[model samples]
Target: MKQKMIDVSIHLFDKKGFTETSIQEIVDELGVTKGTFYYYFTNKQELLTTIHLNFIEFLLKKQEEILQDEAKDSREKLRAMIYMVLQSINERKKSARIFFREMRNLGPKYLEQNVEKRDQFRKNLQQLVEEGIHKGEFQEDLHADMVTRGILGMTNWSYYWYNPEGDVSAEELTDIYVEILLNGINKSD
Candidate 1:
């Protein structure tokens, strides 16, 4: 029942902005009563917070697992991380939309918690870039932090415009992105 409400709410929140989505609408969509919602969640905000936490925590766990694999080089780890994110976007399209778009609607405490997790994710990527540079795989002249942010920006922005059913598959898009990141698009002299 709790997961049902969350799934329905993610669809609603994705289709309609969080501020615009009402408890009544969610309940109606789920064909459940207000008492049932209240039994599980204290209020709409609580539900939103739960959604935000679940989304980030799931991604974070996956990121940590990828980082822990010693057999893969830094480059492979980076590719796997980007692929994981793109795969998540494809699999949980609505939830990804809601996670990125409606995060600001969370209360102060929830917002802070989510932000911490997000920052940690970014830091892990930054560390990967640093490792690549240290190992002489990536250009030593590159700025690790800035490059990390750029990589994340390129992948995360896909949530807004990427169509899972489009001609370009997620794996293809990841290849393009990873190529651009590893090799500049500019023609060599």
Candidate 2:
């Protein structure tokens, strides 16, 4: 029941925007009384916070698993991590949209908690970039923090425009992104 409300809310939030969506509308969509919603979530804001946490926590867990693998090395781990982000966008488009677009609607307490988790993810990626540099997999002078932000910025924004079923598959798009991130756009001699 809790999951149902969240799933429905994500669809509504994605299509209608958080501020525009109402608790009444969510209950109506669920064909349940407001009491039922109250039972599962304290209020609409709590539900939104839950949604935000679920999305980012899912991401952080997957990234941790990828980072822990010993055989992949920095480059493979990087590819897998980017691919994971793209795949999550592809697979959970509605939730991804809500997670990115509806974050501003969360209350101060909720926003701070979400930001901490988000920052941890960014720091973990920076660590990976530093690992790559240390092992000579990436450039020595690279600013890992900036590189981490650039990789995140480039991939995370794809939720707005990337088409999973269009001309390119997710794997193919991952290859293109990895190529660009690792090699850049400059022509080699």
Candidate 3:
């Protein structure tokens, strides 16, 4: 029952902007009464917050696992992280859209919390890039923060057109991204 409510919330929030989506619409999608929603969440905002928190936690856990793996070096960890982003879209495609698209609707405090988590994620990626440069895997001139933001720009944009069921899988796309990311566009002298 709780899962269904969250699912309905995701769909409704994605289709209708968070401001446009009402508690009544979410409950109606679940075919439940208002009381049920109140029982699980105090209001629509709380429900959206809950969903965002869950998604953030999920991403953080994956990131921790990827970073902890010593079998692979920094480059592989970077690939894993990119793969995680694309995989997330495949697994919870609509959730990614809702999580990003509806963020402005979050209360200031809630928005700050989400921003903190997002910052941590970005820092982790930057650290991984730095490690790669130190190891000579990536060019020494590379700026960790710049590379991190570039990767985020590329990966997040995948939501615009990437279909998990379409021609490519997340793993395959990650392989392609890895090549472009670690290698430069310039021709080797």
Mind giving the per-residue lDDT tens digits that candidate 2 earns over 1-189? 899989999999988999999999999998999999999987788999998899899999999999999999999999999999999977989888888888888888689999999999999999999999999999999999999999999889999999977999999989999999999999978
What does candidate 1's lDDT look like per residue over 1-189, in tens digits?
Answer: 999999889888888889999999989988888999999999888999889888888899999999999999998998999999989877877878888888888978678988999899999999999999999999999888999999999988988898869899988988998998888799999
| TM-scores for the candidates | 0.95, 0.97, 0.92
Stretches of model 2 off by over 4 angstroms after superposition = none
lDDT of each: 0.89, 0.92, 0.85
Of candidate 3, the 10-residue stretch with the lowest lDDT total is 177-186
Which candidate gets the maximum TM-score versus the true structure? 2
Question: Residues 1-189, candidate 3, lDDT per residue (tens digit)?
Answer: 888998888888888878898888888888889999999987777788888888878998999999899999987899889999888866887888888788888888678888889889888888888888899988899777887999999898897889867788888889888888777577988
For model 2 the TM-score comes to: 0.97
User: How does model 1 score by TM-score?
Assistant: 0.95
In candidate 1, how many Å is residue 148 off?
A: 0.7
Better of 1 and 3 by lDDT: 1
